[model samples]
Target: MNQNQEIRNQLIKLLEGGIAYQPIEELLKDITADEAGKSISHLPYTIWQLLEHMRITLYDILEFCQNPDYQYLKWPDDYWPKEVAPADQETLDKCIAEIKTGIQTMIKLVQDPANDLFKTFSHGEGQTLMREALLVAEHTAYHTGEVIVLRRLLGTWE
Candidate 1:
């Protein structure tokens, strides 16, 4: 495989493994009593909040990749949805599933040979398809790390 394909494959593995290995269920299994709902000292976001935020961010990136005319937005400070808080195991699982689907869709889009990897699309200044693909990987991995940290703090890592 060429450099771009190699990078894309590596990223897919990283993201897939990150989500697969995460103890999301354990962490949110009993969030009300698990202390996961409580704020941590160093991190500003809770495990639940981070998952939701990451999902939204990845979805936005995918949207931009799929639709060049889509307007991208900054990560809002008040971005969490009040109605769908990750307060329970079921909601957390749903969020994970959604994120996994988004990641898969992004990978599929990038893997399409007909799609121009170097074609510029509308992002802040405009980014090539390859650049956007790499950005998705980078962004997902970063947030996945944060999720791992939160899991650790909640004593859910396994």
Candidate 2:
């Protein structure tokens, strides 16, 4: 593969997870709504909040990368869910699906040769598609780790 293809492959791997990091798609699977809502004593946000934050942040970053008309979300408010746990199983499943969907979208962007990964976005200061993909991967990995630890605390991890 050429350099651009090589870079895109590496990025797709990173976004898909399981290289030097746990896969959020795998980690998120099998978590119940109750488990998602439960908060450990020290951690301020529950799994639901964490997952929502991941979804919202991913959407924001993806929008920034693709949308010249991108609008900024409010810090902490727009990025986080108000509910500790989802209202029901459907809500929980949707959140997980959204996270996975966002990752897939990121992968598509990286895979597209037309997207010039190194070219900076006109809407932002020095942000490139490469940088945004890395940002999404890093952010999701960070929270996916937290979800694992939280699951262990909640006695849900097998």
Candidate 2, residues 1-158: lDDT per residue as tens digits?
79899999999999988888667767888988988999899889998989889988999998998899999888978888888999998998998999899999999999999999999899899999999999998999999998889999999896
Model 1 misplaced regions, further than 4 Å: 1-36, 78-87, 122-124
lDDT of each: 0.66, 0.90
Per-candidate Cα RMSD to the true structure, in Å, reads 4.1, 1.0
Query: Which residue pairs in candidate 1 collide?
Result: none
Cα deviation in Å at residue 120, candidate 1? 0.5
Q: If candidate 1 were superposed on the true structure by all CA atoms, what would the RMSD be?
A: 4.1
Q: Estimate each model's TM-score.
A: 0.74, 0.96
Residue 133's lDDT in candidate 1: 67
- Cα lDDT of model 1 by residue, 64-119, tens digit: 78775787575475345443245676667777778778878877887777777777
Show where candidate 2 strays beyond 4 Å.
Answer: none
